[model samples]
Target: MSQVQTSRFNHKKYQSFQQSMPALKMENRQWPSNSITQAPQWCAVDLRDGNQALIEPMSVAQKQKMWNLMVKMGFKHIEVGFPSASQPDFDFVRWLIEENQIPEDVTIQVLTQARDELIERTYQSLAGAERAIVHVYNSTSPVQREKVFGLDKQGIIDIAVRGAKKVQDEAKKYPMTTWTFEYSPESFSSTETDFAIEVCNAVINVWQPSADNKTIINLPATVECAGPNVFADQVETFCKGVNQRENIIISIHTHNDRGCAVAAAEMAILAGADRIEGTLMGNGERTGNMDLITMAMNLYSQGIDPEIDLSIADEVVATVEECTQIKTHPRHPWFGELVYTAFSGSHQDAIKKCLSVQRDDQQWDVAYLPIDPRDLGRDYQSVIRVNSQSGKGGVAYIMETGFGINLPRWMQIELSRAVQEYSVRHSCEVDNETIYKIFQQQFVQANQNFEQQYQVLGYEVHKQGEQESIQASICDGSVHGETQTIHGQGKGVISALSDGLHKTLGIDFQVQHFDQIALSKGTNSQAMAFVQIKINNRKYMGVSEHQDIMTATINSVLAAINAYIDAVQ
Candidate 1:
């Protein structure tokens, strides 16, 4: 039987349905030439759009917690909810007003559709808000008009104009409360540029805003269907064509269907947008809104204060994760747990060197790190991690940062090889504790085979004339288990001890290197000694820690001798 053949995917089948968004025809576009030098007005829509998209919408208590967090984070404008859509939303709005949870400086905004009953219900919910923005929107895109609303261009304009007029009239019933009107051509990105301008101007005329009373003209990329540049062009065209530009504040609300919400928002600001509406970490409908945290940090990285206090970023992420039941991705910019950690050998080495230099000028100049982690309350200890890919520099960094053990330059490479071998055998990351244990077992502690081979019983040193004399007691590990005493003279105690060992035990080994450092800064602090020696053409390293400097040096030399003996036997 002949085998069935499979052909390549049929690309022609999808061609008939493909469509391309036309670029806006505009000359002398200024947005391309403009740079974002200052931060735009920020409005958090977390409690409204973000809450609604949750698998289980936030309860009143959860909503209150989120609201309090946002207030503490320095947000002056927060869209609390779409009061006219659901009972919980309406109840939360009413609770804020009744319980006096809203701060006086904060302006709460609520969303509604372009209908009389919804607008009236929305205004009723905002009965006693100190200052509120009554946001009204209608579907104005060509596809939305033809497919969703089944309305013509004039019919769509009537919805926006009628809603603006209703919002203006309903706001009068509560004369004590101040109201600002906001209108959106809901799918402005997909709408015809001229028609969007026409509808927005009609609403602007109906509201008749002035310098004292500003109207917000929000253009939402309800569904991102084009590249970010095209969205910027649409924004620029509306800014140029809209009427009463002086009294109008252009606001942008972009979704992340194409993963370009943040880019679009930034470009919109370049295109003369005055306000940005988004949720924390980009939580919203479908692909979610632009992440306010990411965008704000982007601005902060460029030396601009984003006007929001993100120093408590970890707390913010924790609260959002607990409330939303969604774990933040480990690679989330500026806030993720692993974002500040370095595992690559070259990266860890560079970071280790960069942190060692003391600079009087406080500038974030570290390589592979855009912003200092300390700015977000993270310490430098966790910045470098040791794994199979780590190098000697990283191992040294862990030792110094974690345990205050500054290994010598040659010792670093030696210890790094041992650590890399262990990491490869286990195929996992080595923690600081594990690395410390390895250091102890390899240098400070005697190997199991040579545990009772030789022990430093006691030692005493005295200066005689121009040289030092040492008398030492030692134990020999043999079938007889004999103890011996010997005396020798040399330049120093360590040298005298070496000479004593050769004279008494008949074991000769030359000390190659010797170094010592205080383990801490205090009069009674302990000291650690490192010793390297060559015995029978084989080199070995050892370390010892004790309160007395002389004792630590003797113990280190004995440990190195035992290590070499264990290797040979």
Candidate 2:
């Protein structure tokens, strides 16, 4: 081992892995030309790998909960636990078998070391299993062999061969159950490529696999030491050198020591790896294992079927957090709370523009959004949040989607300024309900400080053919809403009300922009009226909601008039 000195850092710990490990000699790598066009055979190692890495391991009940969720998520191959290592793990395996909770299509897997007692106990735990995999491993890397075990190459080979034989012998006793054997040269990526092939080949020779009974040769980057490209090279070389290609399923389990676990896994798939072993959200030792959620969703984003049920992303994150007791980072890829949200001014503007023209039948092409949030049971309400960094488009989007008030461009610009000022003053992001209150205070009821206001008491409209007449009682902004009767005639009820207001208020203004829509879906009874008027060439708007559309229209006219009155006085 070598150490170096640097002024900024202790460059000491570091020399590239090339110094310690033999460099892979594959000039003609084939993985670079390949792309991940299909999903691989996925096996979830949550129960074993994910559980062991947790600070506090999951209870039996928690383990069962996770197991059922995995089954629900369409995981056909699940590594249940290391049955021989713990009594609870052994009991859980027995519970699955005795209670018949294992689905026929799903094959539960258990792990063991090369020792005979654990190997036999692993088999005993799978006594009545319909189909199960017995995964056995031994460390084959140079460091593990020389420093940890103080063994030569032949010693590692003998351990793997003996473990394979013991596993085969145990399977013969449980003839009623179907068994699949798996071998991992633990820390396979850190081992010399040729030596790893030798150990796995020795194990394969003992198992004598066939086309019908394929053995899984899982090559894990147990401690990731190289870049994804280098790992791809290793995988390609192993796939080419390994024997019994047709009778072998080349699998990979990668760690995130270098923060490239998912990338390495994808590259390995291109290098002819057929199956993948990982935990949900990449839960494992050290930097954790490859994340199956990210891997599957990556495939989904590329239009490939992931073969897993990932419709409710929240459900997956919640379940994993509960079992692991590890709170997911809010910025975790794909499933985090803020993953799909945007608060940047430019980003929000672009997202709102792209989403406005998006159609469900068309391909997703929204700017700043890789996939539709609705695909994961999330509405667009959270897609654009208004903070100090937000823009008009985001404010308008939140208002329209969250509260059913679609602001026009000018209105969006006006209200967004108010929202920005509020956010800056309070130094916090504004939530939806708070934004609604802001809209109400600023636009709909701008006369909140006015001592005198208009109130619509009651009205009657008599329609004779196309002409109409209205008789109404209204308060003229007096101290106690003193009642006054007014009458007017016009072609419609709206015109009649306007004419009556013109006579009673002693002020005249034409409606500039008026629109109304049902505030809630399914019925038009609950309606909101938007009325805008120009006073002295300046625009003022008012909004009013009521069970009766007629009352809403009358109140909105009064509200706009009152806003104008406040401005003038």
**In every candidate, how many clashes are there?**
0, 1
lDDT of 2 by residue, 44-126 (tens): 99999999998999999899999989999999999999999988899999999999999989999999999999999998888
Q: Which stretches of candidate 1 lie over 4 Å from their true place?
A: 1-19, 358-361, 447-449, 457-473, 478-513
- TM-score for each predicted model, relative to the true structure: 0.91, 0.85
Cα RMSD for candidate 1?
Answer: 3.0
Report the number of the highest-lDDT candidate. Answer: 2
Cα lDDT tens digits for candidate 1, 427-519 = 999999999898888767643236456666787789988799988777767535577787988998778988988887677999988898888
Deviation from native of the Cα of residue 139 in model 2, angstroms? 0.8
